[model samples]
Target: MSGIYIHIPFCKQACHYCDFHFSTSMKKKEEMVLAIAKEIQMRKSEFKNEIVETIYFGGGTPSVLTSAEINFLIAEVYKYYSVSDNPEITLEANPDDLSSERIIELSKSKINRLSIGIQSFFEDDLQLMNRAHNSAEARKCLEVATQYFDNISLDLIYGIPDSSQNGEQAQQMSNEKWKQNIETALSFGIPHISSYALTVEPKTALNKLIQTGKIAAPKDDVAQEHFAILIEMLEANDFIHYELSNFGKENYFSKNNSAYWLGKKYIGIGPSAHSYDGVSRSWNVSNNALYLKSIQEGKIPNEIEILSVMDRYNEYVMTGLRTIWGVSLDKIESEFGSGYLEYLNNQSRKFLDDDLLFIENGILKPTKKGKFLTDGIASDLFILN
Candidate 1:
């Protein structure tokens, strides 16, 4: 089954660590919503034959849109595409936007899932990341949201660097405090979590802060230690480490995200959104104004690349290794040729010997030790062309 990812490219305010395409201006919100709907209509033919099983409202912050605006978009999807009877419609939101009334309103809408961004449960961490929501709002939103929605996912950012102390970098969160954050999230009774490390992307305020010594850079050793604690704590509480950074309880894996890892086709809507067909991948222009202008002109503002066999293999290896599904060695041999298969085996030999990777029932997967480092390991196994 395929999916459609709609990028809402507006935010209430800019987060320092975010490099995602977004405008802090709400001036173009109305025009953008119209453009997005029109684009959905324009791209229906692309997914004409595939059943749209997932409709994901992602990025800069979907909850910024009113429920009616959101409903209008979902209506457009149903109008043009052959959607499944029960499509997984998810809206990525921030805690500040999810007030009790807002939560109730969202629960009544077509959005069956909420991925709330709760970077941290402490005020200092919130201030450091410049998150739109505070520690109290984060907890309150979850408490109320859980009452309205059963299928909810909360985001947590780990490995955040603390303030410089005595001319040395300190950890923002002690292990005990991190555990408290986890416990607080669990207390909300949310079924899913999409946790990630705080990476300082280039050109982001985070990078500049680090360079200017306004903030300490995140330590890899500290991050790894946190990651280990995350896995052990979550798994002990019956949460499956389905993806490298995702933990879900039974029957709660993110269908939209899972579809992506399984190499399913999806059409990405809005600026800076990426789409994938089996043989090619495409992404829209990152500029919102350009996207709106092009969409208004009945043209999709996007670029496409026809995937080489090597490109496809590399992508599959990268994505597959991150999830529990793993990469199928037999499928690799069958689809990419025996030479590619042999190359993978040879490249993976050292990792397998190191117990960082292993083969079971023809599927190659990362070990617990290697799961945290899956991205690095997957790169080592890639066939460079």
Candidate 2:
């Protein structure tokens, strides 16, 4: 099935470690919203006759938009696209923007799911991350959101070197606190979670702080420890470890992201968003004003890239290995030809023998050890030609 992704490129504030395209100054909010609605009508031919099972409102923080605005956007999609009967409409919200009343209002709209950005449950960690929410707000928002939607997902960040708790808590690194957060979410019977390790991108405020010795760099060991904990904890809670950084209860997986991993097609609107067809991918310009102006002129500001055989092969390997389903050798052989499949099998032999990967019924799957070096392994398996 197909999907639709709408990127809202605005945030209340920029996080120290963020490199996403967004503007704190919301001068173009109205213009951008109108542009997005127009874009849906403009791109109707892109997904003609394709039943859309997922609609994701990802962003600089989708919660910043009013319910009325959100409803208008949904109406536009319905007016143009052939959406499924029960499409999963998700909004990415920060904790501070969510309230019990706000969530109730959101529930009345077409939004069926919520992906809350609760980076951490501790005030100190929030301060370090420069998140717009406090610890109390993070906890309270989840409780309130649960009352409105059972299909809720939480996002958490771990492995920040600045995170610490003294005395009894000092015995554990900051990552351990994430376990408590997970348990709290489980208590609420939340359906999904996306956990990631803290990463300092170049040119970000976080990188500058580390460069100036105002903050410590992320530790590899700490990240590994947290990753291990995350996998074990989610598994114990009977959550499906669907993707590398995502877990979901049965039948609650993100259909939008799942479509991406499975190589299904989708259309993306708004700045800094990417779209995929069967054989090619494209991305919109990252500049907000540029995106608005172009769309307003009845043009989609995007660059397209037709995938070379090698590019498609490499992407298949990379995305497949990150999910629990793994890569199917037969599909690879059929799609890329037997020569490419043989090359992958030969390269995977070493990993298979070393117990880093296992093959079952023509499917190549990674072991726990292999998961840590997934990207490297995928790179090696790629056919450069």
Candidate 3:
């Protein structure tokens, strides 16, 4: 009802740090697109009575798809479901795939928002991560994209491995270099930015590279330092830290993701995408071959999980703590009962006393100093799933 997330599972090349589900081969791309449209129609009954407010295109690289293909899937959504009058439709795209011609063509489509993946403007960072785009392509894409799109968001990766001198893992990124990265992004005058640290997940190319001494690992301390600088710089430029990893100017917050943080129901279509209702969660199979096979047979290959009370409580505490809208005490007591609220209060006592968490009015929120540690604190306050 609130949103629909369509996962495009094809990419031109692999990024070392990415762990999302995708495939490099485009042999089945056409079939995949048809299957996605079919799935969208199949799930229409789920939201028959609800108006869809947002539709997000996220994936291996949504930009890899042609404008016609993208529009076809969007057409399927409109045919099957009741969409909002002015829905927020977002497409997640990579820099290399967003050529000058491509950007102009996309501007004519129904998509109203663009989430560009411009991880960094430096050659070292791009090459180290094996990004398909060069630094020039990143800058060029934004220059063209900004001219046609008013609603745009940039993705920046901080705390990238910085050991060019000798490849030492503990060595931190130069403070000035990190500052420059932030400054370069600000020059574009974009409305929103979603930044994150470069984490090393096991079995990924980045992880393997680090294990074989091909690249240095990202340091937590460096990430914290970069995060601090990011907050200071973005806030000074009139951006609000609405969520831990998201910053937006006035009237520019992401409607799709906001719904998720607020625990609203939405459906995910395509291979490896997830869906959620108020009481249960579901996900399509991650394997593209299997997903296509089942969809062609008129069945959605998905697994469902019914959430228990404790499971719901823990999820609430986790998501609620990460955003500007803190957890509501009254809602907790009324919805989850007094026992869970009491347990939360007891578990959060240490955090509240230490200034890591605070109670303002009736909501519990993290302090500036404690913002980065919100996840850990939230986990400690969980009701036990």
Candidate 4:
């Protein structure tokens, strides 16, 4: 099975911390949409042998589009690709876009899942991040959204200065405030949550603010502490930490993300989108105007790289170590041959000895002590060529 990802590269406003490819202007929105549809049709043959199990509309903010516009894209997918009987269609939305009427409209549409960008439940943090939605809008949207959709995921930002740092007295207050955010989300009974630390990426407004002393940089230790709190709280509420940064109740884990991690093929449509075909990886040009022009000229403006054996093994190691599905020894031996398997066994010994990783049922998994450091651990296990 495969998945189709449609990237909507337009946003209502720019968030300070975000570095994703997007435009705040709506000048080229219509043209971009049409180009995406054309691109989808153009790439249909790429997945000819596979059935699409998921269709994800990710972006700067998919909710910026009208319901009719969203339906038009979905229709384009159905027209060209072979989709599964009950494909999980997810739309990444923001709180300001999900008004009562909009929620009702979406509930009647083909979108089965909604990934709301509710970065924080506090006014200060929202302001800090320059999110389009205020605290009230954040809560109100979730209240209305829960009535229409059970399969919802909310994005929360941790490690903000107000919520995850400072001296002992300040830390206590921050913990309480952070706890309230989690408890508030729990009160809404959200099934899935995707949370992350506020990393100041280069060329972002947040990084500049930090440089100018307008905002403090996020501390890694503080983020780690907040992550621990998050895991403990969610697990107590019956949510499984399926992925390092994702928690879900029972079967509510993200199917699209799971497919990607399992190395299933997926085609990404629109500017800045990416695609994987098990042997090669490609990404479209990040410029909206350039992308539209290229598609109009009947060409896919993208870069592709053929994966070597070491590349595939390293990717598997990176993705597998981040989820509940640990790295499989037998699969490595069978797929990558005994040399890679031997290398893995030799390299993993230190982590095992340190109790950071353990093998059970022939699968290597990070222990609780090593969960927060999975990326580093995974990198250490990489088969360097």
Candidate 5:
């Protein structure tokens, strides 16, 4: 089944390291939501069968929308698409927006999953990232949220301002202390977790701070070490490291994202979101005013690209290598012809010999060592022709 993604391009405040297309000014909230609903209605035929299996509310912060706004948006989705009986509808929320009343409202709505952005449990780290929530609110929201939903996921930021990871005056948190954060969520029976290192993206406020010597740059070694610890700790807690940055226990994998990884078709609504079918990819313009005005004029301000054979091969190599499923030689042979399959087999030989990759049941899977360097290896194996 296909999926749908809606982008809410407004945030209460900007996180220093974020580079997402969002505006802190939410004067256009009502207009934006209406436009998104209209966009979905206009593009209803994009996916032949409206039997959608997943719907994702991602954004500047989906939580920024009021409960009434969320209800209206979801109603529009139901009107436009034929939702699955058991659809996985997820909303990306921040800690500050989640209260007992809001959580109860969300539980009663069609939304079945909550992906909370509780980036750090430390007040200082929250301050460093310009996160709007404090340590107490971060801890409290989870308590309020869990009382309503069982299939919950949370985000955690690692390699932040900490003496443990080597910040000048930051308190040293023990590895056990790091696990404490994970354990707290797991205790709530959280089914999924997405954690990432604090990356200083170019032109971001965090990058500017590092340049001005106001904040330190993240250490790669320290980030890697933290990642290792995170993996070990979560695995011990029975969470499956399904994707590089995502972990899930039992059957709680993100269906919307899993569809993307498996190369399934999906449509995206609103500004700055991407849409992909097997053969082509497209994205809406990131500007809110322009996006709404164009859509109102019966135009989709977007660009599309039809994938070439080489492009498809490269994409397969890139996405396939990131997952536990790896690249299947049989899949390549069937889809791209035997010549391309032979080329891949020959190219992967070096990695196989180095113990970075292994051929298991004709599928090339990455070793623990290979996972860290997947991007480089995927590039090396790309069919440029």
Candidate 6:
């Protein structure tokens, strides 16, 4: 089974910490949607051998579009692709855009899942991130959304400047408030949550603010503490810490993301979207105007990279180490031959001895201590060719 990812590269406003490709303008929104649908139809042969089990509307902010526009795109996928009878279609939304009427409308559509960008329930944190939604709207939208959609995932951001940091005292989100944010989200009874630490990427508003001393940078130690709190609270509440950043209750794990982590093929449509077919990876241009122009000319504006043996192996190790499934030693041996298997075994010795990693039933997984540093551990296991 495979998946289709459609990127809606438009946002109502830019979040201070965001570095994703998106425009705050809706001038080209209609043209972009049409291009995305055309690109989906054009790339049908890419996944001709596979049945689509998931269709993900990732973004900019998918909620910016009307329900009719979303359904139109879904219809295009149905027309050109062999979709599973019960495909999981998810839409990424921001709280401000998900009004009561919008939620009701979305529920009637084919979209079954909602990934709300709640970020935080605290007003100060929301302002710090420059999120379009206020604290009231954040809670209000979820209250309304959960009633209409059961398979919902709320995104939360931790690691903002706290009282200890030298930022605007009014904007500081204390540890106690952070815990309250977690508790508030739990009170919603949502099935899935995708939490992430506040990161400052270069060229982002947050980065420039920090550089100009207008805002304090996010502290790594603080983020680690927040992450610990998240895991402890979620696990205590019966949520499975399935992946590093994702937690789901039982079978509610995101199929679209899970398919990617499991190395299933998926086609990404729209500007700045990335795709993979077992051996090669491709990404569309990030420029909206250029993407539309190329697609209008019946050409897909993208770059492709053919994966080498080492590239594929490194990716497997990287993605596998971050999830509950872990990396399979037998698959490594069968797929990459004995030489790579031996290399992995030798490279994993130090981490295994340090109790950071463990092997159970031929699956190598990161221990709780190693989960926070899975990327570093995965890098150590990479085979440099």
**Pairs with steric clashes in candidate 2:** none
Where does the lowest 10-residue lDDT sum fall in candidate 2? 163-172
- Clashing pairs in model 5, backbone N/Cα/C closer than 3 A: none
Q: What is the Cα-based TM-score of model 6? A: 0.97
Give TM-scores for every candidate, taking all chains together and pairing residue i with residue i.
0.98, 0.96, 0.98, 0.97, 0.95, 0.97
Candidate 4 or 3, higher TM-score:
3
What is the lDDT for 165 in model 5? 33
Q: Please state every model's RMSD to the true fold in angstroms.
A: 1.2, 2.4, 1.1, 2.2, 2.1, 1.6
Give the Cα-based TM-score of candidate 1 against the true structure: 0.98
Worst 10 residues of 4 by lDDT: 164-173
**CA lDDT for candidate 1:** 0.92
What stretches of model 1 exceed 4 Å from their correct place? 164-168
Clashing pairs in 3: none
Candidate 5 lDDT over 187-247, as tens digits, reads: 7777899998788899799998778666667776766677788888889989998887889
Give candidate 3's error at residue 382 in angstroms.
1.0
- Candidate 3 TM-score, C-alpha based: 0.98
Tens digit per residue, CA lDDT, model 2, 1-385 = 9999999999999999999989998888988999999988999999997998899999999889999999999999999989889999999999888888898899899999999998777787788788999988988988888888979889888787653432121232455476776676677778898988888899788888778766677787888888888889889989989898899999999988899998999999899999999899999999998998899898989999999988988999999999998999988988989998889989999999999999888789889977867888998898775
Misplaced by over 4 Å in model 3 are 166-170
Model 4 C-alpha lDDT per residue in residues 1-385, reported as the tens digit of each score: 7999999999999999999999999999988899999999999889888899999999989899999999999999999989999999999999999999999999999999999999889988888789999999999999999999989999998888652332222232266777889999999999999999888999999888778766677888878888889999999999999998999999999999999999999999999999999999999999998999999999999999999999999999999999999999999999999999999999999999999999999999999988989999999999786
lDDT of 6 by residue, 39-112 (tens): 99999999787899999999999999999999999999999999999999999999889999999999999999
Residues 51-137, candidate 1, lDDT per residue (tens digit)? Answer: 999999998998999999999999999999999999999999998998899999989989999999998998888888888889899
TM-score of model 2 relative to the true fold? 0.96
Q: Against the true structure, candidate 2 has what lDDT?
A: 0.87
